[model samples]
Target: MHELIVSPFLGNHLVVRPGSPKGLKVPKHRYLELQQAAEADGAIPGWLHKPVLRQWGLDLRGQNARPALLVRDTVSHEYGRASYEVNMACNWECPHCYLGLKEDTGMEWSDRELLLYLLRDAGVLWLQLTGGEPTIDRQFPAVYSLAYELGMMIEVLTNGSRLHNPLLLSLLTERRPYRLTLSLYGATEESYDRLTQRRGAWKAFRRGVDAALEAGLPVELSVIVTRDNEHEIDAMYDLARSLDVRTREYNNMTPTYFGSGETLSAQALTRGGQRGVFTGCDAGHTSLHVDPLGMASICKVARDKQLPLLTEGLDGLSKLGGIADQALLRQGGCSGCQLSEQCSTCMPLAQRYRQANAPLGSYCQHTPKEVTTA
Candidate 1:
């Protein structure tokens, strides 16, 4: 059973147990002093009761009590150590996308509201906003504004196509938080265009990067490892060095695809004729994904909903505990395989390959196993 308590500092409602270590404590004299102060300031209404200080005591006397205090205590211990994904939309259509494809409609407002409330309530100080291109949504700016107001430092992952627009640059310039991550598919236009699948996307992305740099936005670059561009990794780093950005900060490419499962296949992905599951992920525990539909998922790579739809509010996110636990278990050929750390084995992608005849193809094939892990 959860009991609500009002925090003295934030003045927000927090659900905790009466005897839990996380519960608020007010001495009798202090309580009386606060009550008197409230009365003097005319802040006390007739509905307000007299101050009553209660001592902390565990109520373990009841039958059928299933360690409520223990559960609450565990939750409190992990209070601020959670991560969230705002959405799964991207402007580019890279060969490897874990979240699947974009729907005809945009994200619902209810889902956004639920995520906002949850982040605020859970005291999540950092949030990453992703998408088919989070910036493509007109609501992107508003969401950034709200995250800022609530004190969360926002990080954005984008293909850098929209940042070329002056208005968009100005908006991002005004409300900067951490930095924007730009995914670089290739160093040159010909190479980049081949990966993006859209003609002129390379030019647009380059211009977007220039706009971001001109606006003085802190930016990072991410490259996806693919057979087409695997040899260019060193050159990409050289380009980063010339740009005067942090070259060491570059993220190695992963072959995780974002759209429909129909795009990738296991036969195409298997290396050395050995099919194995991707392992060593604490995914459901430390990370979470909130899809456009407002459903909570473990990893963007997996389509399964670990928690119920967060329509009620942020508090509903607590329901994800069971899903997180279940994800720890492995099945099929993935069981007990040692390649977990080196392979970008996404369950959704594997399922997609199995459903269709698509093969598992990723930039990982071009990268050395050690370097890929590195």
Candidate 2:
């Protein structure tokens, strides 16, 4: 017999069955039995059973037998990787932006010092530089250079608003195998401007994209679903294809704690309630968010001070035990969702719902309700 423990975090149940070198084989009937037992004992929510079963390879009809938990502690350890968000200053004011606030003035040396301490101490080998716009940070090159010196694989998420700076472009060109994730607000100027709420932003973003391409940087484009531009998804996809870029990644516009949720909701409702309930989130366990203040949060959208698992130093992080044990227990709205597979339940989206005191209006024309249905 294997001892299986189910812990909830960010609305998903992490099933840990200890002492099983081989993953445990769980049949549908047995899972249901566990669910009923837990529910009767007030230990688990009924809503969770479906998603957990689905995640463990149990079919909807509950007919599948012997769904095993294929466990490899070594594999699990390797899956545990360290990631950090370097900064939170961006150049654009897109309505769906989620960095909390804009501060183009750049980070002080003290801020950089804290970042360096955290990165070094955490043993972070993979890093992500995100911001209101990371390239807009005057110290971005310094930050990038330090990460490179530390031999960390770096990924940058930007709006492409400031990619044309010659020095910045040169730095990126000199860095080999770096990834640039660009946010495409719209496929055309009319839609783009409306989404970003800034005139000439469209042109600037285009130039930035071209510059990144010319610099030979590996680039990936992300698009946020909003009411004003749902129809343009295919158009953006076509544009990415034309640029010899990969497919446009789609994210549901989530509101953050800092005054951006209202704008995101307005855009979502205007787009005919395309955004809906977020059912699944993988923060705290597989992914983590580090704020500009050096606080480690389970999700970027939910910047709860109480959930700061790690402060701004590697020493603090190491003292917290293994990264796997730091997984956050799920709470609030995410606790009741059933569509763990199809829904985009992230911190930013959760923050929007928290701000609105209601569910996010739909902005995803491409996501059918059935896809997220329980």
Clashes of each: 28, 23
Predictions in order: lDDT: 0.54, 0.55
Could you tell me every candidate's TM-score relative to the true structure? 0.63, 0.63
RMSD of 1: 12.7
Tens-digit lDDT track of model 1 for 11-71: 2222233212244444444444434443344332222122211423433223221222111
Highest lDDT among the candidates is held by which one?
2
Query: After superposing candidate 2, which stretches have Cα over 4 Å from the reference?
Result: 1-87, 104-107, 258-260, 266-282, 285-287, 306-312, 318-352, 360-374
Q: Write the per-residue lDDT of candidate 2 for residues 1-374, one digit (tens) a residue.
A: 11234322222324533211122334445445555544444333344347656544433243221222211111111112344555555546666665546654444666666665455444443467776676766677888776655444567878887888888888776654246888887789999988778889899999999988887778888766577777787788888889887645555554555534555543543233434545554444445566655566545554544234333344334323333233233335444345443344443444456666654333222334433322
Model 2 clashes, total count: 23
